[model samples]
Target: MYILQTVVVKQVLTEKMKRQLLLSYEEQKSQLQREYEQLRFEQKKAEKKYKNSKKESAQLYEKEMQKRLDKIQNIEFQVNQLSLLPLGSELKEQELQTMTEVNVGDRWSDIENEKTIIIKDGIIIDIR
Candidate 1:
């Protein structure tokens, strides 16, 4: 029989990989900052256009703006942590669903233990 299994993909942080990750994080921060600015602009415009409903409109826009600001802060923290970590640190990158074949007598422990894939410099280095 075959079943779908969750596999973990980990990345080994080399210098190149670290730089790439930092760049990606910076890009995310920039986009979020833009979004935050846009939200502020919209909120001000809304307040100017609708004096009677200014409080409600401002609250709604503030909530969305806060979400974006929180994300930017999180990404900033990740960037700082990543910069402090040394090379060869392992980071859990993502998870993937894969098809696996199972026999009647297969050991569940073994199958579960072998679900991690390690990547370095964009290439897979190990599966364990």
Candidate 2:
């Protein structure tokens, strides 16, 4: 029989990877800022269209804008934290599901422990 199991993928952080991650975070923050601006514009437009219920429209749009602001702040915090980590540190990149063949005598304990794949410099370095 075959069953699906989760596997963890970890990346060994190098200088290059660190820079790339920082760049990615910056890009995300910038995108969120753009969305926030767009939201503000929309809120203003809504207020003009619904003068009688401007307060309600403003409140709704403010809520959505706050969400984007929070996301931008989170990305900034992550960037700060990532900067402090030392090189060669293992970071959990992602998780993937794989099919595993099982027999009647398969050891449950071993199967229960998910496998980890370690990558360094874009190459697979180890599997544990």
Which candidate number maximizes TM-score?
A: 2
lDDT, residue 31, candidate 1:
97
Q: What tens digits encode model 1's per-residue C-alpha lDDT throughout 1-128? A: 88889999999999999888889998999999999999999998998999999889999999999999899989989988998998998999899999999898899887776489999998999998
Provide the lDDT at 3 for model 2: 91
Per-residue lDDT of candidate 2, residues 1-128 (tens digit): 99999999999999999989999998999999999999999998888888999988888999999999999989989988998999989999999999998899999989889999999989999999
The predictions' CA RMSDs to the true structure, in order, are: 1.5, 1.3
TM-scores, all candidates, are 0.91, 0.92
Q: What do the candidate models score in CA lDDT, each in turn?
A: 0.91, 0.94
- Which residue ranges in model 1 land beyond 4 Å of their true spot? none
